[model samples]
Target: MPDSLAAALTGLAFGLSLIVAIGAQNAFVLRTGLRRTHVLPVVAVCALSDAVLILAGVGGLGTLVDRHPAVLTVARVAGAAFLLGYAVVAARRALRPGAVLTAEDGDAAPARVWPVVATCLALTWLNPHVYLDTVVLLGSVAGTHGDARWWFGGGAVLGSLIWFTGLGYGARLLRPLFARPGAWRVLDAAIALVMVAIAASLLLGL
Candidate 1:
Protein backbone atom coordinates (compact mmCIF):
# COMPACT_ATOMS: atom_id res chain seq x y z
CA MET A 1 0.00 0.00 0.00
CA PRO A 2 1.00 3.60 -0.53
CA ASP A 3 2.35 5.51 2.42
CA SER A 4 -0.73 7.73 2.45
CA LEU A 5 -3.06 4.76 2.46
CA ALA A 6 -1.08 3.05 5.16
CA ALA A 7 -1.00 6.20 7.28
CA ALA A 8 -4.72 6.72 6.87
CA LEU A 9 -5.50 3.17 7.95
CA THR A 10 -3.26 3.47 10.95
CA GLY A 11 -4.90 6.73 11.95
CA LEU A 12 -8.37 5.26 11.56
CA ALA A 13 -7.60 2.27 13.74
CA PHE A 14 -5.84 4.35 16.36
CA GLY A 15 -8.64 6.90 16.45
CA LEU A 16 -11.26 4.22 16.88
CA SER A 17 -9.25 2.62 19.64
CA LEU A 18 -9.02 5.89 21.51
CA ILE A 19 -12.69 6.86 21.11
CA VAL A 20 -14.45 3.48 21.38
CA ALA A 21 -14.09 3.46 25.14
CA ILE A 22 -16.90 4.71 27.36
CA GLY A 23 -16.23 8.25 28.47
CA ALA A 24 -18.06 11.43 29.43
CA GLN A 25 -18.66 12.48 25.82
CA ASN A 26 -19.80 9.03 24.77
CA ALA A 27 -22.16 8.82 27.73
CA PHE A 28 -23.73 12.17 26.89
CA VAL A 29 -24.07 11.18 23.27
CA LEU A 30 -25.68 7.89 24.22
CA ARG A 31 -28.22 9.61 26.48
CA THR A 32 -29.04 12.26 23.96
CA GLY A 33 -29.35 9.65 21.25
CA LEU A 34 -31.72 7.57 23.36
CA ARG A 35 -33.91 10.62 23.92
CA ARG A 36 -33.93 11.30 20.16
CA THR A 37 -33.61 15.00 20.86
CA HIS A 38 -31.48 17.17 18.64
CA VAL A 39 -29.53 14.11 17.65
CA LEU A 40 -28.31 15.59 14.37
CA PRO A 41 -26.91 18.71 15.92
CA VAL A 42 -25.32 16.79 18.73
CA VAL A 43 -23.66 14.34 16.39
CA ALA A 44 -22.51 17.15 14.14
CA VAL A 45 -20.99 19.02 17.03
CA CYS A 46 -19.08 15.99 18.19
CA ALA A 47 -17.76 15.05 14.74
CA LEU A 48 -16.88 18.62 13.82
CA SER A 49 -15.19 19.25 17.13
CA ASP A 50 -13.09 16.15 16.65
CA ALA A 51 -12.21 17.26 13.14
CA VAL A 52 -11.01 20.62 14.41
CA LEU A 53 -8.94 19.07 17.17
CA ILE A 54 -7.48 16.44 14.87
CA LEU A 55 -6.56 19.09 12.33
CA ALA A 56 -5.01 21.24 15.01
CA GLY A 57 -3.00 18.28 16.21
CA VAL A 58 -1.77 17.51 12.72
CA GLY A 59 -0.92 21.17 12.26
CA GLY A 60 1.51 21.09 15.17
CA LEU A 61 -0.62 22.52 17.96
CA GLY A 62 0.34 19.40 19.84
CA THR A 63 3.79 20.84 20.31
CA LEU A 64 2.38 23.94 21.92
CA VAL A 65 0.13 21.87 24.17
CA ASP A 66 3.06 19.74 25.22
CA ARG A 67 4.93 22.84 26.25
CA HIS A 68 2.04 24.08 28.37
CA PRO A 69 1.12 21.52 30.99
CA ALA A 70 -0.96 24.17 32.73
CA VAL A 71 -3.48 24.10 29.88
CA LEU A 72 -4.29 20.46 30.56
CA THR A 73 -4.39 21.19 34.29
CA VAL A 74 -6.98 23.91 33.91
CA ALA A 75 -9.02 21.82 31.51
CA ARG A 76 -8.85 18.91 33.91
CA VAL A 77 -10.29 20.98 36.75
CA ALA A 78 -13.08 22.49 34.68
CA GLY A 79 -13.94 19.18 33.06
CA ALA A 80 -14.11 17.41 36.41
CA ALA A 81 -16.44 20.05 37.84
CA PHE A 82 -18.68 19.92 34.81
CA LEU A 83 -18.82 16.13 34.87
CA LEU A 84 -19.71 16.14 38.57
CA GLY A 85 -22.52 18.63 38.00
CA TYR A 86 -23.84 16.53 35.14
CA ALA A 87 -23.59 13.45 37.31
CA VAL A 88 -25.83 15.11 39.89
CA VAL A 89 -28.39 15.86 37.22
CA ALA A 90 -28.25 12.30 35.95
CA ALA A 91 -28.58 11.01 39.49
CA ARG A 92 -31.66 13.16 40.01
CA ARG A 93 -33.21 11.80 36.83
CA ALA A 94 -32.40 8.29 37.92
CA LEU A 95 -34.12 8.91 41.23
CA ARG A 96 -37.28 10.32 39.65
CA PRO A 97 -37.86 7.11 37.66
CA GLY A 98 -40.82 8.20 35.55
CA ALA A 99 -39.27 9.12 32.22
CA VAL A 100 -40.15 6.70 29.43
CA LEU A 101 -39.79 6.77 25.67
CA THR A 102 -42.15 5.87 22.83
CA ALA A 103 -41.90 5.88 19.08
CA GLU A 104 -44.66 8.42 18.58
CA ASP A 105 -44.14 10.49 21.70
CA GLY A 106 -40.78 11.07 23.33
CA ASP A 107 -40.21 10.96 27.07
CA ALA A 108 -41.11 14.62 27.18
CA ALA A 109 -41.10 17.63 24.94
CA PRO A 110 -37.88 17.79 23.03
CA ALA A 111 -35.36 20.20 24.44
CA ARG A 112 -34.60 23.46 22.68
CA VAL A 113 -31.90 23.19 20.06
CA TRP A 114 -29.21 25.58 21.22
CA PRO A 115 -28.99 24.28 24.75
CA VAL A 116 -28.47 20.74 23.55
CA VAL A 117 -25.91 21.93 21.04
CA ALA A 118 -24.11 23.88 23.72
CA THR A 119 -24.07 20.92 26.03
CA CYS A 120 -22.67 18.72 23.27
CA LEU A 121 -19.96 21.25 22.60
CA ALA A 122 -19.03 21.46 26.24
CA LEU A 123 -19.00 17.73 26.63
CA THR A 124 -16.70 17.39 23.65
CA TRP A 125 -14.44 20.36 24.30
CA LEU A 126 -14.20 20.56 28.07
CA ASN A 127 -12.85 17.06 28.59
CA PRO A 128 -9.09 16.95 28.94
CA HIS A 129 -9.15 13.36 27.75
CA VAL A 130 -10.30 14.61 24.35
CA TYR A 131 -7.22 16.77 24.17
CA LEU A 132 -4.96 13.95 25.18
CA ASP A 133 -6.45 11.64 22.59
CA THR A 134 -6.96 13.97 19.64
CA VAL A 135 -4.31 16.61 20.19
CA VAL A 136 -1.37 15.03 21.91
CA LEU A 137 -1.54 11.33 21.07
CA LEU A 138 -3.08 11.51 17.63
CA GLY A 139 -0.98 14.48 16.67
CA SER A 140 2.19 12.82 17.80
CA VAL A 141 1.33 9.72 15.84
CA ALA A 142 0.36 11.65 12.74
CA GLY A 143 3.68 13.46 12.85
CA THR A 144 5.38 10.20 12.12
CA HIS A 145 3.57 10.10 8.80
CA GLY A 146 5.46 13.26 7.69
CA ASP A 147 3.92 14.31 4.39
CA ALA A 148 0.95 12.01 4.99
CA ARG A 149 0.07 13.55 8.34
CA TRP A 150 -2.90 15.41 6.86
CA TRP A 151 -4.18 12.15 5.37
CA PHE A 152 -3.82 10.56 8.76
CA GLY A 153 -5.75 13.39 10.35
CA GLY A 154 -8.42 13.06 7.71
CA GLY A 155 -8.76 9.38 8.47
CA ALA A 156 -9.11 10.08 12.15
CA VAL A 157 -11.76 12.68 11.42
CA LEU A 158 -13.61 10.19 9.27
CA GLY A 159 -13.54 7.68 12.07
CA SER A 160 -15.03 10.22 14.44
CA LEU A 161 -17.79 11.11 12.01
CA ILE A 162 -18.64 7.48 11.43
CA TRP A 163 -18.73 6.66 15.13
CA PHE A 164 -20.86 9.63 16.20
CA THR A 165 -23.27 9.25 13.31
CA GLY A 166 -23.76 5.57 13.97
CA LEU A 167 -24.11 6.10 17.69
CA GLY A 168 -26.64 8.93 17.38
CA TYR A 169 -28.75 7.34 14.69
CA GLY A 170 -28.47 3.74 15.79
CA ALA A 171 -29.56 4.44 19.34
CA ARG A 172 -33.16 4.58 18.21
CA LEU A 173 -33.04 0.84 17.63
CA LEU A 174 -32.88 0.42 21.39
CA ARG A 175 -36.05 2.44 21.89
CA PRO A 176 -38.00 -0.71 22.59
CA LEU A 177 -35.76 -1.52 25.48
CA PHE A 178 -35.91 2.07 26.76
CA ALA A 179 -39.71 2.18 26.45
CA ARG A 180 -39.89 1.24 30.10
CA PRO A 181 -39.35 3.80 32.85
CA GLY A 182 -37.25 1.28 34.72
CA ALA A 183 -34.91 0.96 31.78
CA TRP A 184 -34.51 4.73 31.62
CA ARG A 185 -33.83 4.84 35.32
CA VAL A 186 -31.23 2.18 34.96
CA LEU A 187 -29.63 4.04 32.07
CA ASP A 188 -29.55 7.31 33.94
CA ALA A 189 -28.06 5.60 36.95
CA ALA A 190 -25.37 4.05 34.80
CA ILE A 191 -24.68 7.39 33.19
CA ALA A 192 -24.36 8.94 36.62
CA LEU A 193 -21.85 6.28 37.62
CA VAL A 194 -19.83 6.82 34.44
CA MET A 195 -19.78 10.55 34.98
CA VAL A 196 -18.74 10.22 38.61
CA ALA A 197 -16.02 7.74 37.81
CA ILE A 198 -14.61 9.88 35.00
CA ALA A 199 -14.74 12.97 37.20
CA ALA A 200 -12.97 11.19 40.01
CA SER A 201 -10.30 9.96 37.66
CA LEU A 202 -9.75 13.43 36.32
CA LEU A 203 -9.58 15.03 39.76
CA LEU A 204 -7.36 12.34 41.20
CA GLY A 205 -5.21 12.18 38.04
CA LEU A 206 -5.65 8.43 37.90
Candidate 2:
Protein backbone atom coordinates (compact mmCIF):
# COMPACT_ATOMS: atom_id res chain seq x y z
CA MET A 1 0.00 0.00 0.00
CA PRO A 2 2.81 2.35 0.77
CA ASP A 3 4.36 1.58 -2.59
CA SER A 4 1.00 2.10 -4.24
CA LEU A 5 0.67 5.42 -2.46
CA ALA A 6 4.11 6.44 -3.63
CA ALA A 7 3.35 5.47 -7.21
CA ALA A 8 0.09 7.32 -7.15
CA LEU A 9 1.82 10.35 -5.76
CA THR A 10 4.51 10.05 -8.40
CA GLY A 11 1.90 9.75 -11.10
CA LEU A 12 0.16 12.81 -9.81
CA ALA A 13 3.42 14.68 -9.99
CA PHE A 14 4.07 13.34 -13.47
CA GLY A 15 0.63 14.34 -14.76
CA LEU A 16 0.75 17.76 -13.20
CA SER A 17 4.26 18.37 -14.42
CA LEU A 18 3.24 17.83 -18.04
CA ILE A 19 -0.24 19.36 -18.03
CA VAL A 20 0.32 22.31 -15.77
CA ALA A 21 2.04 24.11 -18.59
CA ILE A 22 0.24 26.75 -20.68
CA GLY A 23 -1.36 25.45 -23.85
CA ALA A 24 -4.43 25.75 -26.06
CA GLN A 25 -6.69 23.50 -23.97
CA ASN A 26 -6.04 25.33 -20.72
CA ALA A 27 -6.44 28.69 -22.41
CA PHE A 28 -9.71 27.64 -24.07
CA VAL A 29 -11.04 26.20 -20.83
CA LEU A 30 -10.16 29.36 -18.97
CA ARG A 31 -11.75 31.51 -21.66
CA THR A 32 -14.92 29.41 -21.76
CA GLY A 33 -15.20 29.36 -17.99
CA LEU A 34 -14.84 33.09 -17.90
CA ARG A 35 -17.52 33.40 -20.55
CA ARG A 36 -19.90 31.32 -18.42
CA THR A 37 -20.89 29.19 -21.36
CA HIS A 38 -20.64 25.47 -22.04
CA VAL A 39 -18.37 25.08 -19.05
CA LEU A 40 -19.52 21.61 -17.93
CA PRO A 41 -19.35 19.98 -21.35
CA VAL A 42 -15.98 21.55 -22.00
CA VAL A 43 -14.60 20.23 -18.77
CA ALA A 44 -16.00 16.75 -19.39
CA VAL A 45 -14.49 16.59 -22.85
CA CYS A 46 -11.07 17.63 -21.64
CA ALA A 47 -11.07 15.19 -18.72
CA LEU A 48 -12.42 12.25 -20.72
CA SER A 49 -9.95 12.80 -23.54
CA ASP A 50 -7.10 12.83 -21.06
CA ALA A 51 -8.35 9.55 -19.60
CA VAL A 52 -8.18 7.88 -23.00
CA LEU A 53 -4.69 9.16 -23.72
CA ILE A 54 -3.44 8.24 -20.28
CA LEU A 55 -4.84 4.77 -20.78
CA ALA A 56 -3.04 4.54 -24.09
CA GLY A 57 0.13 5.71 -22.44
CA VAL A 58 -0.13 3.10 -19.70
CA GLY A 59 -0.78 0.28 -22.20
CA GLY A 60 2.48 1.09 -24.02
CA LEU A 61 0.83 2.73 -27.02
CA GLY A 62 2.56 5.94 -26.13
CA THR A 63 5.84 4.43 -27.20
CA LEU A 64 4.38 3.79 -30.62
CA VAL A 65 3.33 7.41 -30.82
CA ASP A 66 6.76 8.50 -29.73
CA ARG A 67 8.37 6.54 -32.56
CA HIS A 68 6.34 8.27 -35.25
CA PRO A 69 8.28 11.49 -35.37
CA ALA A 70 6.76 12.67 -38.66
CA VAL A 71 3.18 12.25 -37.51
CA LEU A 72 3.95 14.02 -34.26
CA THR A 73 5.58 16.90 -36.07
CA VAL A 74 2.57 17.42 -38.31
CA ALA A 75 0.29 17.39 -35.29
CA ARG A 76 2.45 19.87 -33.42
CA VAL A 77 2.51 22.35 -36.28
CA ALA A 78 -1.22 21.98 -36.90
CA GLY A 79 -2.04 22.32 -33.24
CA ALA A 80 0.13 25.38 -32.98
CA ALA A 81 -1.68 26.96 -35.91
CA PHE A 82 -5.08 26.33 -34.34
CA LEU A 83 -3.87 27.86 -31.12
CA LEU A 84 -2.57 30.88 -32.96
CA GLY A 85 -5.93 31.33 -34.69
CA TYR A 86 -7.63 31.19 -31.34
CA ALA A 87 -5.21 33.77 -30.04
CA VAL A 88 -6.23 36.14 -32.79
CA VAL A 89 -9.90 35.76 -31.97
CA ALA A 90 -9.22 36.22 -28.28
CA ALA A 91 -7.34 39.38 -29.02
CA ARG A 92 -10.21 40.66 -31.14
CA ARG A 93 -12.58 39.94 -28.27
CA ALA A 94 -10.37 41.92 -25.93
CA LEU A 95 -10.56 44.92 -28.18
CA ARG A 96 -14.33 44.81 -28.36
CA PRO A 97 -15.43 46.26 -25.07
CA GLY A 98 -19.07 45.16 -25.10
CA ALA A 99 -18.75 41.51 -26.12
CA VAL A 100 -21.01 39.32 -23.95
CA LEU A 101 -19.05 36.08 -24.50
CA THR A 102 -22.17 33.91 -24.41
CA ALA A 103 -23.50 31.22 -26.71
CA GLU A 104 -25.34 33.91 -28.60
CA ASP A 105 -22.10 35.68 -29.28
CA GLY A 106 -20.63 32.74 -31.17
CA ASP A 107 -21.02 31.74 -34.82
CA ALA A 108 -22.71 28.44 -34.00
CA ALA A 109 -26.03 30.29 -33.92
CA PRO A 110 -27.86 27.35 -32.27
CA ALA A 111 -25.15 27.07 -29.63
CA ARG A 112 -25.33 23.32 -29.02
CA VAL A 113 -23.29 21.70 -26.28
CA TRP A 114 -22.01 19.00 -28.63
CA PRO A 115 -19.88 21.42 -30.61
CA VAL A 116 -18.19 22.72 -27.49
CA VAL A 117 -17.57 19.18 -26.30
CA ALA A 118 -16.30 18.23 -29.74
CA THR A 119 -13.96 21.19 -29.87
CA CYS A 120 -12.49 20.44 -26.48
CA LEU A 121 -12.07 16.78 -27.35
CA ALA A 122 -10.28 17.63 -30.57
CA LEU A 123 -8.05 20.10 -28.82
CA THR A 124 -7.10 17.60 -26.15
CA TRP A 125 -6.87 14.53 -28.35
CA LEU A 126 -5.29 15.81 -31.56
CA ASN A 127 -2.36 17.56 -29.95
CA PRO A 128 0.89 15.55 -30.10
CA HIS A 129 2.31 17.10 -26.97
CA VAL A 130 -0.35 15.40 -24.82
CA TYR A 131 1.04 12.03 -25.88
CA LEU A 132 4.57 13.13 -25.13
CA ASP A 133 3.45 14.45 -21.78
CA THR A 134 1.28 11.56 -20.58
CA VAL A 135 1.98 8.54 -22.75
CA VAL A 136 5.68 8.65 -23.61
CA LEU A 137 7.23 10.94 -21.06
CA LEU A 138 5.20 10.07 -18.01
CA GLY A 139 4.76 6.45 -19.02
CA SER A 140 8.50 5.99 -19.48
CA VAL A 141 9.12 7.60 -16.15
CA ALA A 142 6.48 5.56 -14.34
CA GLY A 143 7.21 2.22 -16.03
CA THR A 144 10.44 1.98 -14.07
CA HIS A 145 8.34 0.54 -11.25
CA GLY A 146 6.69 -2.69 -12.34
CA ASP A 147 3.58 -3.13 -10.19
CA ALA A 148 3.35 0.54 -9.38
CA ARG A 149 2.48 1.50 -12.96
CA TRP A 150 -1.25 1.22 -12.33
CA TRP A 151 -0.96 3.49 -9.36
CA PHE A 152 0.86 6.00 -11.51
CA GLY A 153 -1.68 5.79 -14.30
CA GLY A 154 -4.58 6.18 -11.91
CA GLY A 155 -2.89 9.11 -10.22
CA ALA A 156 -2.22 10.85 -13.54
CA VAL A 157 -5.79 10.54 -14.79
CA LEU A 158 -7.16 11.77 -11.48
CA GLY A 159 -4.83 14.74 -11.64
CA SER A 160 -6.21 15.65 -15.06
CA LEU A 161 -9.82 15.27 -13.89
CA ILE A 162 -9.11 17.45 -10.89
CA TRP A 163 -7.26 20.11 -12.85
CA PHE A 164 -9.58 20.62 -15.88
CA THR A 165 -12.61 20.65 -13.55
CA GLY A 166 -11.00 23.03 -11.11
CA LEU A 167 -9.77 25.30 -13.85
CA GLY A 168 -13.18 25.30 -15.54
CA TYR A 169 -15.19 25.65 -12.34
CA GLY A 170 -12.73 27.82 -10.51
CA ALA A 171 -12.91 30.49 -13.19
CA ARG A 172 -16.50 31.05 -12.10
CA LEU A 173 -15.26 32.51 -8.86
CA LEU A 174 -13.80 35.33 -10.92
CA ARG A 175 -17.25 36.36 -12.16
CA PRO A 176 -17.32 39.40 -9.96
CA LEU A 177 -13.94 40.46 -11.21
CA PHE A 178 -15.02 40.04 -14.83
CA ALA A 179 -18.28 41.80 -14.14
CA ARG A 180 -16.52 45.07 -14.26
CA PRO A 181 -15.96 45.83 -17.93
CA GLY A 182 -12.43 46.91 -17.25
CA ALA A 183 -11.61 43.65 -15.53
CA TRP A 184 -13.12 41.70 -18.38
CA ARG A 185 -10.78 43.36 -20.85
CA VAL A 186 -7.85 42.61 -18.63
CA LEU A 187 -8.79 38.96 -18.29
CA ASP A 188 -9.52 38.45 -21.96
CA ALA A 189 -6.33 40.19 -23.01
CA ALA A 190 -4.35 38.10 -20.57
CA ILE A 191 -5.87 34.93 -22.00
CA ALA A 192 -5.08 36.11 -25.53
CA LEU A 193 -1.49 36.90 -24.67
CA VAL A 194 -0.93 33.55 -23.04
CA MET A 195 -2.42 31.68 -25.98
CA VAL A 196 -0.27 33.51 -28.47
CA ALA A 197 2.80 33.02 -26.36
CA ILE A 198 2.27 29.28 -26.11
CA ALA A 199 1.58 29.04 -29.79
CA ALA A 200 4.77 30.92 -30.53
CA SER A 201 6.73 28.65 -28.24
CA LEU A 202 5.46 25.60 -30.05
CA LEU A 203 6.18 27.01 -33.50
CA LEU A 204 9.61 28.18 -32.48
CA GLY A 205 10.47 24.79 -31.00
CA LEU A 206 10.93 26.19 -27.56
Candidate 3:
Protein backbone atom coordinates (compact mmCIF):
# COMPACT_ATOMS: atom_id res chain seq x y z
CA MET A 1 0.00 0.00 0.00
CA PRO A 2 1.02 3.58 -0.60
CA ASP A 3 2.32 5.70 2.29
CA SER A 4 -0.73 7.99 2.03
CA LEU A 5 -3.03 5.01 2.33
CA ALA A 6 -1.14 3.78 5.34
CA ALA A 7 -1.33 7.15 7.03
CA ALA A 8 -5.04 7.43 6.31
CA LEU A 9 -5.70 3.98 7.69
CA THR A 10 -3.70 4.73 10.81
CA GLY A 11 -5.64 7.92 11.36
CA LEU A 12 -8.94 6.18 10.86
CA ALA A 13 -8.05 3.52 13.39
CA PHE A 14 -6.78 6.04 15.90
CA GLY A 15 -9.85 8.25 15.54
CA LEU A 16 -12.20 5.37 16.07
CA SER A 17 -10.24 4.27 19.10
CA LEU A 18 -10.65 7.69 20.61
CA ILE A 19 -14.30 8.26 19.73
CA VAL A 20 -15.89 4.84 20.22
CA ALA A 21 -16.37 5.22 23.94
CA ILE A 22 -19.23 6.05 26.23
CA GLY A 23 -19.42 9.78 26.97
CA ALA A 24 -21.72 12.77 27.33
CA GLN A 25 -21.85 13.51 23.60
CA ASN A 26 -22.59 9.94 22.65
CA ALA A 27 -25.27 9.72 25.31
CA PHE A 28 -27.02 12.83 23.98
CA VAL A 29 -26.81 11.65 20.40
CA LEU A 30 -28.21 8.28 21.37
CA ARG A 31 -31.10 9.87 23.23
CA THR A 32 -31.88 12.22 20.37
CA GLY A 33 -31.71 9.44 17.82
CA LEU A 34 -33.95 7.23 19.90
CA ARG A 35 -36.51 10.00 20.10
CA ARG A 36 -36.30 10.50 16.35
CA THR A 37 -35.90 14.17 16.92
CA HIS A 38 -33.79 16.26 14.53
CA VAL A 39 -31.39 13.39 13.96
CA LEU A 40 -29.90 14.86 10.80
CA PRO A 41 -28.95 18.16 12.37
CA VAL A 42 -27.47 16.54 15.43
CA VAL A 43 -25.39 14.14 13.40
CA ALA A 44 -24.33 16.92 11.08
CA VAL A 45 -23.25 19.11 13.96
CA CYS A 46 -21.18 16.37 15.56
CA ALA A 47 -19.52 15.26 12.35
CA LEU A 48 -18.85 18.78 11.16
CA SER A 49 -17.48 19.84 14.53
CA ASP A 50 -15.14 16.88 14.61
CA ALA A 51 -14.02 17.62 11.08
CA VAL A 52 -13.16 21.20 11.98
CA LEU A 53 -11.24 20.19 15.10
CA ILE A 54 -9.33 17.46 13.30
CA LEU A 55 -8.38 19.80 10.47
CA ALA A 56 -7.37 22.47 12.94
CA GLY A 57 -5.23 19.95 14.74
CA VAL A 58 -3.60 18.88 11.54
CA GLY A 59 -2.89 22.53 10.87
CA GLY A 60 -0.92 22.74 14.12
CA LEU A 61 -3.51 24.18 16.52
CA GLY A 62 -2.59 21.51 19.03
CA THR A 63 0.67 23.22 19.92
CA LEU A 64 -1.14 26.42 20.68
CA VAL A 65 -3.64 24.60 22.91
CA ASP A 66 -0.77 23.00 24.81
CA ARG A 67 0.86 26.36 25.32
CA HIS A 68 -2.28 27.76 26.89
CA PRO A 69 -3.48 25.70 29.84
CA ALA A 70 -6.13 28.25 30.76
CA VAL A 71 -8.14 27.49 27.65
CA LEU A 72 -8.76 23.90 28.69
CA THR A 73 -9.34 24.94 32.28
CA VAL A 74 -12.17 27.22 31.24
CA ALA A 75 -13.63 24.57 29.01
CA ARG A 76 -13.45 21.99 31.79
CA VAL A 77 -15.32 24.15 34.27
CA ALA A 78 -18.00 25.17 31.79
CA GLY A 79 -18.42 21.65 30.50
CA ALA A 80 -18.84 20.31 34.02
CA ALA A 81 -21.53 22.85 34.76
CA PHE A 82 -23.38 22.07 31.57
CA LEU A 83 -23.18 18.36 32.12
CA LEU A 84 -24.50 18.72 35.64
CA GLY A 85 -27.44 20.76 34.41
CA TYR A 86 -28.20 18.17 31.77
CA ALA A 87 -27.99 15.46 34.37
CA VAL A 88 -30.62 17.21 36.45
CA VAL A 89 -32.89 17.35 33.44
CA ALA A 90 -32.35 13.69 32.74
CA ALA A 91 -33.01 12.80 36.35
CA ARG A 92 -36.24 14.74 36.30
CA ARG A 93 -37.36 13.02 33.16
CA ALA A 94 -36.53 9.67 34.63
CA LEU A 95 -38.59 10.47 37.71
CA ARG A 96 -41.57 11.60 35.67
CA PRO A 97 -43.89 8.71 35.06
CA GLY A 98 -45.30 10.37 31.94
CA ALA A 99 -41.96 10.51 30.19
CA VAL A 100 -42.79 8.10 27.43
CA LEU A 101 -41.70 7.99 23.84
CA THR A 102 -44.50 9.42 21.74
CA ALA A 103 -45.76 7.69 18.70
CA GLU A 104 -45.17 9.13 15.24
CA ASP A 105 -48.51 10.88 15.22
CA GLY A 106 -48.99 11.16 18.95
CA ASP A 107 -50.34 14.24 20.71
CA ALA A 108 -46.93 14.96 22.21
CA ALA A 109 -44.83 17.48 20.37
CA PRO A 110 -41.24 17.11 19.34
CA ALA A 111 -38.50 19.34 20.72
CA ARG A 112 -37.73 22.60 18.96
CA VAL A 113 -34.97 22.25 16.39
CA TRP A 114 -32.77 25.12 17.43
CA PRO A 115 -32.67 24.16 21.09
CA VAL A 116 -31.58 20.68 20.19
CA VAL A 117 -29.03 22.12 17.82
CA ALA A 118 -27.77 24.41 20.53
CA THR A 119 -27.45 21.54 22.95
CA CYS A 120 -25.55 19.56 20.37
CA LEU A 121 -23.20 22.44 19.84
CA ALA A 122 -22.64 22.83 23.55
CA LEU A 123 -21.98 19.14 24.03
CA THR A 124 -19.55 19.16 21.14
CA TRP A 125 -17.74 22.38 21.89
CA LEU A 126 -17.72 22.76 25.66
CA ASN A 127 -16.05 19.44 26.42
CA PRO A 128 -12.31 19.80 26.94
CA HIS A 129 -11.84 16.07 26.28
CA VAL A 130 -12.88 16.61 22.66
CA TYR A 131 -10.05 19.04 22.15
CA LEU A 132 -7.61 16.78 23.92
CA ASP A 133 -8.64 13.82 21.77
CA THR A 134 -9.05 15.46 18.38
CA VAL A 135 -6.81 18.48 18.51
CA VAL A 136 -3.95 17.49 20.78
CA LEU A 137 -3.75 13.71 20.54
CA LEU A 138 -4.77 13.30 16.92
CA GLY A 139 -2.73 16.30 15.85
CA SER A 140 0.33 14.99 17.59
CA VAL A 141 -0.19 11.64 15.91
CA ALA A 142 -0.70 13.23 12.50
CA GLY A 143 2.58 15.11 12.86
CA THR A 144 4.38 11.80 12.67
CA HIS A 145 3.00 11.39 9.14
CA GLY A 146 5.01 14.39 7.90
CA ASP A 147 3.70 15.26 4.42
CA ALA A 148 0.81 12.82 4.76
CA ARG A 149 -0.63 14.50 7.85
CA TRP A 150 -3.49 16.02 5.87
CA TRP A 151 -4.44 12.63 4.53
CA PHE A 152 -4.37 11.35 8.10
CA GLY A 153 -6.64 14.16 9.17
CA GLY A 154 -8.94 13.41 6.26
CA GLY A 155 -9.18 9.81 7.36
CA ALA A 156 -9.94 10.89 10.90
CA VAL A 157 -12.61 13.24 9.58
CA LEU A 158 -14.12 10.44 7.52
CA GLY A 159 -14.16 8.19 10.55
CA SER A 160 -16.02 10.81 12.56
CA LEU A 161 -18.59 11.30 9.79
CA ILE A 162 -19.20 7.60 9.56
CA TRP A 163 -19.48 7.13 13.31
CA PHE A 164 -21.85 10.01 14.03
CA THR A 165 -24.00 9.34 10.97
CA GLY A 166 -24.27 5.69 11.80
CA LEU A 167 -24.93 6.39 15.48
CA GLY A 168 -27.60 9.03 14.84
CA TYR A 169 -29.38 7.11 12.10
CA GLY A 170 -28.89 3.68 13.59
CA ALA A 171 -30.43 4.47 16.97
CA ARG A 172 -33.91 4.04 15.52
CA LEU A 173 -33.36 0.30 15.58
CA LEU A 174 -33.71 0.52 19.36
CA ARG A 175 -37.01 2.31 19.02
CA PRO A 176 -38.86 -0.91 19.68
CA LEU A 177 -37.25 -1.24 23.07
CA PHE A 178 -37.66 2.43 23.94
CA ALA A 179 -41.33 2.28 23.11
CA ARG A 180 -42.01 1.35 26.72
CA PRO A 181 -42.18 4.10 29.27
CA GLY A 182 -40.19 1.99 31.69
CA ALA A 183 -37.47 1.61 29.11
CA TRP A 184 -37.35 5.37 28.73
CA ARG A 185 -37.07 5.80 32.45
CA VAL A 186 -34.24 3.32 32.57
CA LEU A 187 -32.42 5.06 29.76
CA ASP A 188 -32.86 8.49 31.29
CA ALA A 189 -31.68 7.23 34.65
CA ALA A 190 -28.59 5.77 33.03
CA ILE A 191 -27.98 9.01 31.20
CA ALA A 192 -28.26 10.93 34.41
CA LEU A 193 -25.72 8.70 36.09
CA VAL A 194 -23.31 8.96 33.20
CA MET A 195 -23.59 12.73 33.07
CA VAL A 196 -23.05 13.14 36.79
CA ALA A 197 -20.09 10.83 36.76
CA ILE A 198 -18.51 12.68 33.90
CA ALA A 199 -19.19 16.03 35.52
CA ALA A 200 -17.65 14.88 38.77
CA SER A 201 -14.62 13.67 36.93
CA LEU A 202 -14.27 16.98 35.17
CA LEU A 203 -14.70 19.03 38.32
CA LEU A 204 -12.23 16.94 40.26
CA GLY A 205 -9.75 17.18 37.42
CA LEU A 206 -9.75 13.44 37.00
lDDT of each: 0.87, 0.77, 0.90
Of candidate 2, the 10-residue stretch with the lowest lDDT total is 101-110
Worst 10 residues of 3 by lDDT: 99-108
- Rank candidates, lDDT, best first: 3, 1, 2
Model 2 per-residue lDDT tens digits across residues 92-197: 7789976634432432343577877776876786676787777788778778868888888999999999999999989878766665666766766887787677
- Give TM-scores for every candidate, taking all chains together and pairing residue i with residue i: 0.95, 0.87, 0.96
Model 1, residue 94: displacement in angstroms?
0.4
Give RMSD (Å) of candidate 3 vs. truth: 1.5
What's model 1's overall lDDT?
Answer: 0.87
Pairs in clash, predicted candidate 1? none
Q: State how far residue 88 of model 2 sits from its true place (Å).
A: 1.4
Clash numbers, per candidate: 0, 0, 0
lDDT of model 3 at residue 141? 97
Candidate order, TM-score descending: 3, 1, 2
Give the Å shift of residue 31 in candidate 1.
1.5
Better candidate number, 1 or 3, judged by TM-score = 3
The runs of at least 3 residues in candidate 1 whose Cα sits more than 4 Å from the true structure, single-residue gaps closed, are 99-108
Report the C-alpha displacement of residue 92, candidate 2, in angstroms.
Answer: 0.9
RMSD values for the candidates in order, in angstroms, are 1.5, 3.0, 1.5
